[model samples]
Target chain A: MESVRKKRRKARVDETLCVACGCCVKVCPLGAIAVVNGLYARVDTARCVGCGKCAKECPASVIEVQEVEV
Target chain B: MKKTNQKHWYDYLWIASLLYLILGFFNILFAWLGILCFFIPLIISIVRGNKAYCNRYCGRGQLFSLIGGRFGLSRKRDVPRWMKSKAFRYGFLIFFFAMFFQMLWVTGLVFAGAADLRQVVTLLWTFKLPWHWAYHGTLIAPWMAQFAFGFYSVMLTSTVLGLITMILFKPRSWCVYCPMGTMTQLICKARHAGEKNSDKSDFVTEK
Candidate 1:
């Protein structure tokens, strides 16, 4: 029997580069991103479908979509 | 996770907001510069199809973040539900535009010699506070000065309101219902809809 693994695309934020401007928060259809503590943008990976809207909308260009094994 | 506390050039824009207020305080003419604040966001939204100006370049927002977040002035409470509601946000945007149009109308009247220049700043759209001291007669037309005063009043009033909200709630709470933010959001939505329609048309043509 061979073990099978599943992979999915998810959006991730570079905490260092994020400006916490809330642009991602507005553009996210799933409402998975938020400006935390008025400091940086935090993306909730579970709800994020890797749509790339937030990545495109981010002014700082800190967000990226990556394939992850689930 | 290590968070980098790096500062970007745009982060320093709060100084511009402070300088604007200071310059306006010394000379009412400087208030005319507020036009940049009025047009820049809309232009960015139309040209770039995003809210980059509100997110990255808003000096007033940076100022509030500095005061309310860095200085610990904000209670950090979430803004009231009503304030976050679409009805309230749109209502505020409409009310803001009404006030803006009224100011422009007054400026037009002054330009046409239909009304005298009023050297007073109306605070919160109600109380008219005398701002004559800031106005020193210059070589420019009185109507120009009139527009400056009116525009400055709008800018100053909004700034005061933002500071109040910043202190009482989250640092960037004012951004939630900011007229410029609302306008840019609408523009972005319109652009998004237009793009979607075009995509649909392309798909249909291909089929």
Candidate 2:
């Protein structure tokens, strides 16, 4: 028996779950996460460092991070 | 702690675009290399569509788009407002007209064999033109004024042209209008059409 799941986009930050905090923005080493729309900042997944600052500083703890599979 | 920094192979393309532009086009210094940049990617794009150099590569395009995306100038699948942006519309008008006149003048000179280094320098210079007197004569006109204006025109042209072509038609205008894309598709077509003809005989024999 096997299960199939749709592959989600890697390292995407959900805008809805975002609490408009700058922690992830600050913590990113790559300068990837930018506060767009003035409130809910956006993270460019392609540029994410995956250091987990976003996951940690996210007061809502909603910054979901992913790694590229080798 | 052992340091681990991971990066992608494609990053090289960005650097390549920069070096190519710097050593090639900026001076018109390397005629051969500039020819490679102008013609090769154009050939590639025509054959492959957006992937050749426009979408995935082409350092200039990548950088321009990155800057625009940074500033929220990127367009998505959604229909973007047309001419509704007076700034954009007028900006593009000014840009295209300027480019057109400049190119026309250059072409005329080239035909007349009067083109010189002075002309090239003037064309590339920020303060050398008439508009500079009006707009860039302010307190902030000296240093990055050129860069800002260049970016402004480049981004606006690329975006507006893309918007007009893409939103107005399907599969976008890269198929036809883009010089680089058009040239590439021409090459690809010539090659693929030959392959298709070859494949037809094989198919009939198999059947």
Candidate 3:
């Protein structure tokens, strides 16, 4: 038997660059992102499918999607 | 590649917010224009089934971003956890509506000849400040003027609150708990849910 490897995509936010504008929160289709304490946008890896909607809508361009091994 | 700093036509809406404040300063009656800010977001949310107005067209948010981000007025700190909580946001919305209804009640009293119009703008829902200088006895009814005064007070108070929070936290932090933003978000979610249900029904019919 062989073990299987799975890769998934998730959105990441750069807290240093985020302006906490809530644009990503409004555009997130899965409601996977929220502005945490009005500080930065935090993405829930479980809910985010790396759809890139938040990254596209972010005014600060601080969000990026990357593939991760699961 | 999308340029993060690129300016769009909607980016200039900050000017409109400034112009509105200035106009209301000289003549409080001009505050009626605030209704556009109140209704346009709801209308766009209902019609487009999105938060496009809040995302792209909110003048107040733009103004906050300009002053706090561009001008470096904000401390760029994190807002308190309580301010960002759902309980606080919904409570603030309910309180805001209660104050709005009280404003309408006062206006109704004036309209029904049960009370006299007071040329005062209450700040922070207390501390009545005389606003007689702004009025020149226009042809508009007294009740209308009363409503304008009350409405302008609400708008000004909210702006002041936004400015204070902007100075204390990150730019556009006010959007996190803005009553209008909350309302529009709810409307957008409701619309999306309805669309999903309709799509499921269509799929079943096809099957």
Candidate 4:
């Protein structure tokens, strides 16, 4: 039997749907989210502490926090 | 056309918050009530999307704007670019958390019998402030004292920021750098990242 460890969850954005509205950018306490190329929202996972503040502010309902198995 | 700003009813909430702080001198629990005001909204914003608490119910923000508008207390200057920078905001957040957790650690030590309650309370600058008149000669448990000290520490931090920003720039300028605002933003970011793509209408249901 193999045991799988669950890594910490992080917030990620669905780029295709992100309108680059910058709501998440303004709301992120850690400054982990930014609008890239003036088109979509991007998340800096390395900098993101997974506080989930931005997800609540996304008007498009495109951002989500996900769990990863490390 | 130049836009004129309008004041809303909730802006008076700051006055109410101020009253609450004043009342702390009579009954210290009012200070704890102030903590609950921030804590409840913070929890709601984290569990739900968007910072509804800040948008709908921040008494401090309202008070800042109210006094700024009525008394011309604000400098009417823009918040300096650097103060709004991510580095400054996040750096302050980190510092706040460090101090908060340090206090909690001290509380833990007190509970574990390794520290004295009186000494630990002194670690909080506001402990000896004029407001504690209500606290003396009262039968408060050690844990309650520790909690009160923690609340005082938090309030002192906000008051310092509020005073500096309210004086140097526009009123409510502290919102840009508030640690609680930053924490709420982090929670919103994480929630947005974790949720599945859906229509905006689902926003209400998602919560």
Give TM-scores of chain A for all candidates.
0.91, 0.66, 0.92, 0.85
lDDT tens readout by residue for model 4, B29-89: 5556766676865786566655655554677766665666457787756566677666887
Candidate 3 chain B, run of 10 with poorest lDDT: B198-207
lDDT tens digits by residue: candidate 3, B156-205? 88998899988888667778678988777666556665343232211010
Off by over 4 Å in 3: A1-70, B1-5, B194-207
C-alpha lDDT (0 to 100) for residue B3 of candidate 4: 21
Better of 1 and 3 by lDDT: 3
Instruction: Give the per-residue lDDT of model 1 (tens digit) for B54-125.
Output: 666789988887888779898766567678666887899999999999999999999999999998988898
Ranking by lDDT: 3, 1, 4, 2
lDDT of 2 by residue, A1-70 (tens): 6766543334456654333323344345566665432224466655555677556444334467775542
At residue A26, give the lDDT of candidate 3. Answer: 52
Question: Whose DockQ is higher: candidate 1's or candidate 2's?
Answer: 1
Winning candidate number (TM-score): 3
For all candidates, the clash counts are 0, 7, 0, 28
Task: List the TM values for chain B, per candidate.
Answer: 0.90, 0.39, 0.90, 0.78
Off by over 4 Å in 2: A1-70, B1-7, B16-33, B42-56, B75-177, B194-207
Q: How many backbone clashes does candidate 2 have?
A: 7
lDDT of 4 at B4: 17
Clashing residue pairs for model 2: B42-B180, B42-B184, B43-B184, B46-B184, B46-B185, B47-B184, B47-B185
Better of 3 and 4 by DockQ: 3
**Model with the higher TM-score, candidate 1 or 2:** 1
